[model samples]
Target: MALTNSKPKIAIVYASATGHTERLTEMIVDASVSQGLQPEIFPVKEFDLKELLRYDIVVVGTYTWMNGEIPRQLHSLFEAIEQQSGDLVTGVFGTGDRCFATYCGAVDLFRDMLHAKTQLAATLKVEQMPSAEDRLRCDAFMNSVWRKYSQHVENLVAAKP
Candidate 1:
């Protein structure tokens, strides 16, 4: 959906296996609100697939499953978003254990697909949990989302006759 000069609608949706992804979601939410953009939050189970197009930007959070895999809970959501995808600005974040051969593999997976299917803005991956240092990355992630949204609005304006 193309956003007008009004604040662009954004949704932060996630599937947290053991709460790590949820914590990261909270961080992103806090930072976004602090920056004056109120994003709606949805646990993957609670989010309605039909409502995907209501927002101009969609942020996804996930926890990597064993040996580099997208958690089963997120597979449908992934496909649903992809099926309806376009230039919907997207941001992906994930959490995982360092011992895994592919740490944050789900984030990488979503990142790759979103880069192709949507207007991928930024991506972030955290170890099991976030630290104070990770807050900087979270802030940067939000900045990237906003920056991309701004660019999209500019393009829309430029395309006008």
Candidate 2:
């Protein structure tokens, strides 16, 4: 049988207390679809490890809470990713208040974990209540990261001689 190449599947998962992170996830989903890729959105609280591993690319979103730590639900997911042996390509984004001591706290946590664990593709940070420019920058960042990741995957597939 002849094999056909297909577009990669992308998943956007988020944990939000005040909806900021969820909104960002929705934006990523929309952008991914607009770029002619398969994409889905999931709340991190309801995300499953098996489902996450199925995606070729995963975008994680979170809102800062308490200090600069990830929420309990997402911590579990991060732990799972850390323990797994699979190479999960990931992008990260978050929303937080700049007035706080740490701006984009959730994003900070993601950077730390990604540095220690998975191969982090990119990270975008937005204000808690993002401005028009912030939104534009976030969208642009997503586009650039997605394109880079796509190229990386293509190279990997082509190099499998």
Candidate 3:
């Protein structure tokens, strides 16, 4: 859809317990800035679910815990997202120890749900904290999301009466 005159609002909503997800969020935010786009990052508890309507792009980050279960704190957001119409563009990413069978399984869970509920763009999985090498992957993820969003906006504009 054609965005308003104002720049698209992007949100990086995440839940990080041991700070790995938070660190990844920082990397995403930095990549966004480098692309000349400003994005706001919010902890899952702090983000008002209703505010989701205001964003054109939504990025979710989390850490996979025991048995690949979605963390308790993020469950609400997960449900809220699933209830949303499939219009918003979305990306999912997370951190998990590679030793686990379900490494970054939380990201997979979110990916499935978001694909059903929104326009899923990219999904990323990083083992533990992101290292310097992961920056390229992060950039590619952001770029893919932005490219899809831009295409959507262009399609909307072209369809104008």
lDDT by residue for model 3 over 49-119, one digit each (tens)?
99988888889999998998888899988988888877688999899998988888899999999988888
**Residue runs of model 1 more than 4 Å from their true location after superposition:** none
Error of 1 at 118 (Å): 0.6
Extract clashing residue pairs from model 2: none
Q: Residues 45-124, candidate 2: write the lDDT tens digits.
A: 66778776676677788888777777877887777777744355678888888788878877877777775775577888
The top-ranked prediction according to TM-score is 1
TM per candidate comes to 0.95, 0.84, 0.93
Candidate 2: misplaced stretches above 4 Å?
1-5
Error of 1 at 65 (Å): 0.4
Per residue, candidate 1 scores C-alpha lDDT tens digits across 38-151 of 899999999998898888989999999988899998898899878765768899998998898999999999999999898899999999988879988999999999998889
The deviation in Å at residue 41 for candidate 1 is 0.5
Give candidate 3 regions above 4 Å deviation. 1-6
Error of 2 at 115 (Å): 3.7
Ranking by TM-score: 1, 3, 2
